[model samples]
Target: MTAENNGTGTPPPEGDDDPFAYLYRQEGGAGGSAQQPGVPRRSYAQVRAVGERQYGAQAGPSPQAAPGQQPGSGPGLPPHQPNAHYAAPETMPGGRAAARRQAAAAGGGPGGPRKNRNGLLIGAIAVVAAVIVGIGAAIVFNDDSGKQSQGQSDNNDVPGQDEDKNPKNPKDGDKKPAKDKPKPTGLPSRTDAADATLAGGATKQTEVAKAQSAGGAYVGGMDKPGASVTWTLKDIPESGKYTVFVRYGVPGKDADSTLSVNGKQSDRPLNMSNFAGAKKGDWEAGWAETYSWIDLKEGTNRVQVACGDSNTCDFVLDQFWLKRGWVK
Candidate 1:
């Protein structure tokens, strides 16, 4: 009813120029929305059809160059070395040709040769890729290890943790009570005080036999001039240096004091071993550093505590301190 004249009518023929020509000439990427004039508007079916034609053409043999010209002389191919051993097949076969076909069928000609070449190329490529991956993995692992070490260090430095594991940590806890330092043999913890009192008010003070006082108290000398006292020293546990604490008291005039162990002047400054500079005195504090690897004799040893004037530092002869080992 809509087309009253349609029953016997025919449509006009389409134009002759290639309607698909626009599909082949574009240079842009495949997925963008930007439009270009002159480019064919493509439906999915049209695009797929054009693509098949192009792919088939490329996959087939390319056009040959002019007769007598080399394969790579045109823009179509890169420069190449002619394969001297490869020759085009002839239409007519000679005895050599027959033999080559037979060899190929037997796995010694075209098939075997091509197969070997492909396998070698693949193996070489795989080895190179494996080496590259190994190097990359090693570098990554080393970086991760370094990060782990840094993390451990950060953990150790976290607040509220025991710094005993820290290299810069300080000493802590109750120090093991000092061991008795070596003292001059044949003397009690107290031996002098000739009218002076003992340090710390501990009544364990007493005089030694005058005979023991000036005796040959050494495998060396007068273990030093003094009333021998119970000398406590740190245990020589390991190799290192330690500090020894001592206290002394006595009376004298304008007298400075000196402390020594076993005939030798102790190797530490003692400018404050006494405050006797003002007269009638009480105990004064002192300290010393003893090197390890030194054997401390048990029991009493003469620790000459002398109190003297500028002309002499006197020996209070009756004071000693508890000792302990501190390592550095």
Candidate 2:
């Protein structure tokens, strides 16, 4: 009965209203009907065995059941017809086989090959480390090369380091001769005043103490006019200015005398001041020195200490000395 008949015991037209007509249509068989209008069809046996196909095996030909016999049933059982409404769970959408295929694609099922995640991770890390090491080595090599170049440049720029490049000459190594130093002037010449020629009642005496002359004698009695002591010095080294240092003792008062060099009177008188700071009339403690600059000849030069008309002569002469230069 067709769907439109609604169990009225009337069959619909051969192919127009039969819902299961595609299941019964046959090709290249005896008593086969015309082609159906809907999808092309397979036999009932083929449709029933589709769910039974193995996952990896190819489908062979299905065995046709004998008439009035059940598929896979022994002879004691009754014959069973194919149910057109029957559907296998594996053949439906979202079935177990499709779920298993999804599981395998997601790498969770037993059929899927697992990948070594740790090995991939470790290999990536090793490649990155190798790259970093190569970069570091290049940097080190460049730094060392730069330092060596700088060191070489510094060595080349320095002077007096490469002996082979700039050899030393013997004349350049020899030192210059030192200039000759002038000979030192002769030492001072000391003459005792007592040994000098005395005139005009200027006599030599040993009465005063602390006289630096020989035998502690000194020239005395030079207080009057025309009294004088003359010294004739000889063997002067050069014709230059000389210092005439006179050692004299006073009665603790300042006195001075006229000085003449080589028979020419000096412009200024010899100063015989009482530098000792002694009490008046203390001749022993009044011993002091005086000097005068005079121009003399290289040979013998006569020096005179006289009591002139304008002189205040109250000093006793002890010693007269000649220094090469004018000094106090």
Candidate 3:
């Protein structure tokens, strides 16, 4: 074998060899210096063992020196030995043990103590409960407002409650009560044709049968223009609208007369149609009824039926009457 090969024939370095020796040489370390020309390099096994060394073990006996050399003398430096004060990370103060303790204090590490969760859970529950209470309060408030508003609406819908609570002024005693207005009693007040005043050739006649007037009397001679019969009504209960019903007879055809109330002429002539369906000149069978609306005073009023220039007044008046209100 060649002396440079050391009888190993250039085998690959072992796994435990220092791969970073070149970086140590660049930084000019004494341990990384170039070897002397004749000194042999040490093998990795002679340099340092791979496993941990026992720092506190008893020392073994030293090897005998060469015959002429000293006991500690060698051709090159001695093999690397572990320092006497070196310690493992697990055994040193403030190392792996301290780091594990710090991790446990800061909460759970990989498998250390677990953090507290009850506080967060309670806070979330309290928030939900508060929300529920707020919703309940809102519902109650809305219900109360709705009930109050409904009560006010009900009060407004009651009829005449305000009027009953507030009476009329005592100073207006002369005014009639609102409920005292006249209503129809279904009984009409009657005036016979004999009791009416006649003018312009109008005269009372008893010849017609079934007149409905006292003694079968009626007013006649109303065919001439300007002839009229006037009735002065009295003892009216109140001043209001009234209907004047007249009972009259015709000669079988239709006839009409002008009607005036309280001396004011009516806008339209009074209708005296042949409602009885009698033959011509059959005055007794031609008895029929007609009505006109008029306003009357509280105590007295006058109603007149006349033969105007435009009237066909062949009909005779038998009776006149008053109903309380304007009616058909």
Candidate 4:
């Protein structure tokens, strides 16, 4: 029965603001009649069948083009597939999915399967979000790594000179024997030696004292009962400490030993004798040392020591590492 005769009819004026929209939804929207708001004069059997399968096998056209053709080809390259995996991208510039989606929903053309539209929306959003998050994390890590690398580079930098070259005192290698410095600052009062140790910047200080020896090497000390003036240091600094080093060998053999300073003792015993060395003609045994840190109240402190242990070997006092500060 026509709604008009039933008293529930809508106003029949063309001015009805929203008539077609209401009718369109009710008809699944493929068509409408001129006489009635939603009446379609024709019955669409196939269209109805396709629409009924909107969420199932009806999602897209059967993977064929005409009665007998392959899916990805017709004549030239089968135009790029519309990335149909997800809800077609929002308003993709090519206006492709909208018509199909509508036609399928309305049983008009190749209708899509009646799949859960909600799940597809969620999945598409998830993929896009994952890509964005991945890109963001990479950018942050890269920036942090760059800063760390810059810090390490700064630490490895050399300050004043060529990092590759070994450091050396400038006076080294000069031909002229460097004028002997007048001993250390207070060495004169300690013992009288022509030049026991270099005061200025000379690199090496050698033993120039006269001592007891049977062979080419000399060995002497306060070990027995005699006074042995091996080498006299000049003006030894009261603030700095002194280190005694020597090389020695036992009678006819090498022996280990250490030098005593002002009655001081070695943490370990000496290892040598004067003329008695490791090799017959070789006098190659000595220690590189620094003196124990000591503070002397006055200048020209008296310094004394003897060399020898079991065999009292011959020894040569080599170098002294001296610096200004008393606090070592």
Q: Any residue pairs clashing in model 3, and if so which?
A: none
Candidate 4, 24-143: lDDT as tens digits: 322232243232333331232213311123223335432333324433456642444443333443544447677666667875554343355656888999999999999999999999
On the 0 to 100 scale, the lDDT of residue 89 in model 4 is 33
Candidate 1 lDDT by residue in tens digits, 1-328: 1211111122213442344433433323434333243443343232232112321233443334444554345556445423333333442256678768878988889868789999999999999999999999999999999999988887766576655664443476546578986644332332222322323322332332221222312111111333233343433333323333333333333323345555566544344333434344322322121222122345333344443222243333432333334533
Badly placed stretches (over 4 Å) of model 3 are 1-188
Tens digit of per-residue lDDT, candidate 2, span 68-182: 5445454543334333455455655889988787777888776455455666778999999999999999999999999999888766845645546455665787765789755
Against the true structure, what is every candidate's RMSD? 27.3, 21.3, 18.1, 29.3
Please provide, for model 3 over 1-328, each residue's C-alpha lDDT reduced to its tens digit, 9 standing for 90 to 100. 1122222334324552444332222211233334333333443223323222347746553333344553245554244334344655575579997867767777756444433466667889999999999999999999999999988876674554453544577686767557864653343368897789999999989888888887888899989999999998766767889999999899999999999988999999999999999999999899999999988877767899999999997989998887778898
- Deviation from native of the Cα of residue 52 in model 3, angstroms: 99
Candidate 1: give its CA RMSD in angstroms: 27.3
TM-score to native of every candidate shown: 0.21, 0.43, 0.43, 0.23
Which of candidates 2 and 4 reaches a greater lDDT?
2
TM-score of 4: 0.23
How accurate locally, in lDDT, is each candidate?
A: 0.40, 0.76, 0.73, 0.40
